[model samples]
Target: MAKKELKKVFNLNSYEWWRNHRRVVTFGLFLSIFAFYLGNPFHKEGKVKDTCAKLNSSFQITGDEAMKKLNLKEIKNYNNRELANYYCERYLGIK
Candidate 1:
């Protein structure tokens, strides 16, 4: 009996259960969206810029200077500027 009840609860094609728990589902979805926005997951460039600004103010090193100082391994055929930006983001915990 317990196994049968568990199977019913876990049924994927059960619209009846969804309808009965519409409020809970809606609240969960809203909460998820709110958390996602609150986390600012898409503003990576902004974070990098902020970090670089702080680095510049503290060390007097401009973006160009920092890029020129990067000694990355040329294993992949990636662009130098892009690789430098990625390194800066990772080094400063912006990513």
Candidate 2:
């Protein structure tokens, strides 16, 4: 009687596959995470508004003056919370 021969089609336990593809797979996952972060940073809703409001209440400077200080033409292009944070960091020296 002749014995039938079988070939190994899939190597589930092969670490070589992961070793060879590690960089590519890692980069792809990293790119996906970055894309998700860029699309939705998960900042609280109206955080900019809230920060700006607090700044406005605490500081005597008007919004336009703040814009000028920020070297911006207008507030439309900047995020209020980030701007306020930078402002506080510079003026208040708070970490």
Candidate 3:
């Protein structure tokens, strides 16, 4: 007897499914990754504040002021270390 081909269980492999749920899929993936990183064992929540505070003292500004200077495309999208890196790298012109 010949074996029949198995059908797909879901439409996830279909282009139309992706087209219909592009935003949803993208958002869910983003949230999942964000949550994963948030739960990381060595993640520090105040590195940005500490780094900014230290960097700011050199410029005679406050930590809040340094963060205020950050030109984030979406401020809410970043965590502390990411914000610090971006701010120091881009805003403060640090390497």
TM-score of each: 0.35, 0.33, 0.31
Model number with the top TM-score: 1
Clashing pairs in 1: none
What are the per-residue Cα lDDT tens digits for candidate 2 across 1-95? Answer: 12222223444455887999999999999999998787663453244444445566766565555555545444567775466557655654566
- Please write out the lDDT profile of model 3 over residues 1-95, one tens digit for every residue: 12222325433357877889999999999999999887764344355445566654555554345455543343575654456556666644577
State model 2's lDDT.
Answer: 0.60
Model 1, global lDDT: 0.66
Q: Which one wins by lDDT: 2 or 3? A: 2
Q: Top model by lDDT, which number?
A: 1
Worst 10 residues of 1 by lDDT: 66-75
* Candidate number that wins on TM-score, 2 or 3: 2
Better of 1 and 3 by TM-score: 1
lDDT of each: 0.66, 0.60, 0.58
